[model samples]
Target: MSQGRMASGNDSSVTEFIVLGLTQQPELQLPLFFVFLGIYVVTVVGNIGLLILIGLNSHLHTPMYYFLFNLFFIDDCYSSVITPKMLMSFAKQIISYAEHMAQLYFFSFFVIDECCILTSMAYDRYVAICMPLLYKVTMSKQDCLILLVGAYEMGFVGAMAHTICMLKLIFCDGNIINYYMCDISPLLQLSCTSTYSNELVVFIVVGINVVVPSLTIAISYTLILSDILCIRSTVSRSKAFSTCSSHIIVVSLFFGSSAFMYLKPSPAGSLDQDKVFTVFYTIIGRMMNPFIYSLRNKDVQIALRL
Candidate 1:
C-alpha cells in the first residue's frame, strides 16, 4: 500500500515472472486445474452460444439486448485474459514481464468497457421505464452505437494510461506473482522502485471505474423504481422489474467483487483471500453471465426456443 521498497534505477533485472499458482498442496493443484478448466469451457460455450442466439434472433435487436451482446462479448474476453493462463499455471511456465503488462492492459480495458456498458444498460432501462415516450429518440440505433463506441474509447484510454505507468516500474530478479494473475495489486507488490505514482494512477482510474458507473446505475434504477411505484397495475410493474433484474444481479456481482478486489488494501496474509475474490469477477462471473441473462430474459428464452 505504501510506495513500496525503493530501488536504485528504472532498469529491472527480472525479464520474467514465475507465477505461483493457487495452492502449495500438490494434491489440490490437479483438482483446481480441472475445476477451472471446466469453468473456462463453460464460459466459452455460454458466451458464444449467447452471441449466436442474439445474432440469429430478430426480436433481440433492441438496445438492451444489443448491450447484452456486448456484455457477453466482454465477459468472454474478460475471462479469456485470466483463465487459460491460470489453468496452465498448473504446469508452470516463466512468462515475460511484458506478457504480464499485456495481460493487465487487456484486463483493465475490458473491465472499464464492462463498467461503461453496464452504465449504458442502466441508462437504457431508465429510458424504457422512466422516459417511455422519449425512449425511441433517446436510444436510437445511432445512439446505441455511439454509447458502445464511447465505452471502448474510454476503456482504451484508461488501459493505455495504466499500462504506461506500469511499464515505468522496475522489478529485480526472481519476481514471483503471489496470485494467479497480474492484477494491479499483486503486481505492484513486486516493484523494486517506488510505486507511489503508479499506485496513485491505479487508485484514480479504479476509483473512477467503480464509483462513476455505480452512481449511474443507482440513479438510473432509482428513477426507474420511482416510476414503477407510480404504476397503477401490479402486472405492469412486475413486468417492468423483470427486464432489469438480470442486469441488477450482474451489476451486483461485477461491482461487488471488483470493489472488494481493488478498493481495499492487500494485506500480506490475505493474498489467498484475494485469489478467491479474483475468481469471482474474472472467471466465475463470465461463466454465470450468459446463463443469468438468458434465464432472466423472456426475449432471449423465446429466441432460443424459436
Candidate 2:
C-alpha cells in the first residue's frame, strides 16, 4: 500500500487542497452562485425565524415543538456549516486543504447530529399519536432536555471519531476533492495510505446512525398506525394522521437520499456522482425539512399568524 509522507519522509508536514468548484464552465459560475446564494439565504431566515417563533410562542412550548425548535436549530447548523463554504468556493475555486478537512469534520458532525434529532422528532410523533394522555408524562421537559443533550453528544462523538480517523489518513497522492465540501467518502478516496480503519469506522458509525434510527422510526410509526386504526371517528383520525405525515415526508427525503448516496456501490468504485448526491443531502435536504415539516404545517402557520 502507498504511504502518504513528505518528500523528506518527514511525518510532520501539512498539505494543501484544491477544491474543484461546482462547475468549470465560466458561464455557469455566476448563475449557479446566485442560485445557491438565494437558497442559503432562505435556509437561514426560514430556520432562524421558525426557531424564534417557536421560542416566543408560549402555545408552542410543549414537547413536540420543543423538538421542532431543536430541529430548526439543527437545520440552521447544517446550512451554516456547508453553504457558506460552497459560496466561497464560487469566489475562489480552491480551498485550504487542511482547513477544508476541518470544515468537513464539523459538517459531518452536524449531519450526524441531525440524524439523531430527526429520530427524536419521530419518537415524539409516535408518542403524540399513540399515547395522547401519557404524552405529557412520557415526553416531559426533562425528557426533552435529555434527548437534546443526547442528540448533541451523538453528533459530537461521532464527528470526533470520524475526524480523528480522517486525520490519521495519508493524502500525499492528490488533494483534489470532487465535492464542494469535505465529506467522508470523498476524503477517504484521497488517502495515499491504507484506509482499512477509516473504511471500517465509516461502516460501523454510518450503519448505526442510519439503520438504528431508520428501524426505530419504522417501528414507532407502525405502532402509531395500529393505534390510529382503533379510532372510529373519521374526522379525528384524519386530523391525527395529518400531523404525522409531515415528519414521514421529511424523514423519507432526508434518509432516503442519504442511504442512496452512502450505501450504493459503484462499478468503478468512484465517488464523482456521490458529490452531486451530497448537494441534495446537505443543501436541498436542509431546505426541504423546514418546508415540509414547518412552513406547510398547520400548527406552525397558525403560530405565525398569531
Worst 10 residues of 2 by lDDT: 1-10
Candidate 1, residues 25-62: lDDT per residue as tens digits?
79999989889999999999999999999988888889
Q: lDDT per residue, candidate 2, 1-306, as tens digits?
A: 222224536533235666776777789989999999999999888898888888888988888888888888888888988889888887775666578778877887787887888899889988888888899898999999999999888888888888888888877657666667877777777776777787777767778888888999999999989988999999989988888898888889888878876665521255567767778889987887778866557878898788
Q: Estimate TM-scores for all models.
A: 0.94, 0.93
Please give the distance, in angstroms, between residue 51's alpha carbon in candidate 2 and its true position after superposition: 0.9
How does each model score on lDDT?
A: 0.87, 0.80
Which residue pairs show collisions in model 1?
none
Candidate with top lDDT is: 1
Q: Candidate 1: misplaced stretches above 4 Å?
A: 1-12, 265-269
